[model samples]
Target: MTVDSSIMISFSTASKEYDNQTALRDITFMVEKGEMVFITGPSGSGKTTLLKLIYSAERPDSGHISVAGWDINNLKESTIPLLRRHIGVVFQDFRLLANRNIFDNVAMALRIRGAAEREIKTKVYESLKSVGLRHKSDSYPRNLSGGEQQRVVIARATVAEPNLLLADEPTGNLDADTAEGVMRIFKNINAKGTTIMIATHNKELYRNTGKKVIRLDSGNLVDVGKG
Candidate 1:
């Protein structure tokens, strides 16, 4: 198969199984750089598994997968952290530190990257500001609303400006309006050139948005088109 320079994520005949059940089968798709794509399916249709593969949390049992130009099908365990440096992931559960303030939570990303304290301050503030949460930098996760906590998570994920952002049911715990607010933040980030892929079962999130939708059913690719 021809590799396109603009492709940011590629899955070629990838298959994965756990125990006796298949999570994905012969999956082949590509997400272009700077594009926003959605993966949709039912409760256990492998939506989350697909995102895990891209995040390097799970490896394919067969075929090949690539992200940001790196071949990850056989990616070494020691280099997984290096691969993750170029990718940011948001989960359904807001994994914030209750003991740490919002600022510290976001700073953790830069800290892990060995960024200087001065640089961390500047970038964390910028990221929080981008998500419209700079004012809550001093607040703890429990003190914030559900939507606010999710925004803090977004701030944390994008603090290092990763080239690719992957989200798994990011808005699952929010109301309709709050979910849209989070999505708008994603759109703004993608406008600046980061590739994004969101896995969700909520059709309301992608309806009328005109973004590419890849649907899965029983680990099979069932549909691919504009949402």
Candidate 2:
């Protein structure tokens, strides 16, 4: 297939296996820049594995995967960090450092990239404000409610303005109202031209978002539709 400049993510015959179990099978798809697509299916349908491939946490077993023009399948170990700088991943469980306050947690990404202290402070504050968590910037993760913690994770993921945003069940732990609020934040980020691919089982959230949906089942990609 000819690679399109507009395509930010592409997978060709990609598969992942653990011993005898195959998590993904011959998966192929393209995610264009600035598009929002949902990966939806029952549990264990390879949604998370697909996201992991994009994020370079795992390599495909048999095929090629590319993200933001970087060939993840053949990426050098030293370059993985550089590749991840262009992608933001939000996990089902908010991966916040328990001891760190919200500002420090959100600033960690920039810090790792060697951003100056003044820049980190400004960017971290702006990120927290975007999530409406500016007041809680000094609070530890343990002190925040589940919804609040998730917002902090979101803030951290987007603070650097990544080119691609991968959210795996981002709203899974929230109540309906809180989930809606989080969805709105995702929408706002997408509006700013960031590519968004969300893995979720929440049918209502998918329907309400009105974005293209990519369904998967038992390691097979189903179809794109308005789920």
Candidate 3:
């Protein structure tokens, strides 16, 4: 594929290794601005490792990764927060704080950036509303169902209005119906022109989405096409 000048993500021969195991091998691809893409593979196929490399959670052992024009392979520790502010990440596990209320949980993203109290409140509620969870603002994670908590996690991740969002097996824990609902929320977010990359092993999630798919096998890029 020909990479455009405005590509939001670009990987050139990127590779990552942990101990003796290679999580990724010479992976290369580019995602244009505002594009939605899926990284599909089976368990232990390095889907999670790819997401981690993009978000700077894990560095590549060789090659390059650039996100929103920032070179992740050479990313500095002090600048990680700045890089993350423009990128949102959703984990398979909800990763919500059990002690915090839904509102605070979502608001935390804005708060860490020194946003004003009023702005934080507005953004948090707006994000919650997007996930259909505004009414549960006062509830804790323990009080919500699995799907609801995942939605809250989504809300928190996106409340910062990131330029790119990376989700690793977002629907892995939800039932089919609930997973569909989560997918809809992602679609709505994508409609607003925010780029999204979802890592999922479930074929049902992208069966008819028509989004671009990057298929991985044994840490290698096997195919790139429509879903």
How do the residues 138-211 of candidate 1 rate in per-residue lDDT, one tens digit apiece? 99999999999989998888999999998889898899999999999999999999999999999998999999
Clashes of each: 0, 0, 0
After superposition, the stretches of candidate 3 with alpha carbons farther than 4 Å from their true spots are 1-5
Question: What ranges in model 1 sit over 4 Å off?
Answer: none
**Least lDDT summed over 10 consecutive residues: which range in candidate 3?**
1-10
Error of 2 at 85 (Å): 0.3
Give the number of colliding residue pairs in candidate 1.
Answer: 0
For each candidate, give its TM-score against the true structure.
0.97, 0.97, 0.97
Q: Model-by-model lDDT, in order?
A: 0.92, 0.91, 0.92
lDDT of 3 by residue, 98-156 (tens): 89999999998899899999999999999999999999999999999989999999999
lDDT of 1 at 58: 95
How many residue-pair clashes does candidate 2 contain?
Answer: 0
Model 1 TM-score, all chains together:
0.97
Q: Which stretches of candidate 2 lie over 4 Å from their true place?
A: none
Scored against the true structure, residue 190 in model 1 reaches a CA lDDT of 93
Cα lDDT tens digits, model 2, 1-227, are 45689999999989999887999999888889999999999999999999999998999999888889898878999999999999888888888999898899999989988999999999999999999999999899999999999899999999999999999998998999999999999999999999999999988888855678989998888887864
Q: After superposition, how far is residue 200 of candidate 2 from its true place, in Å?
A: 0.4
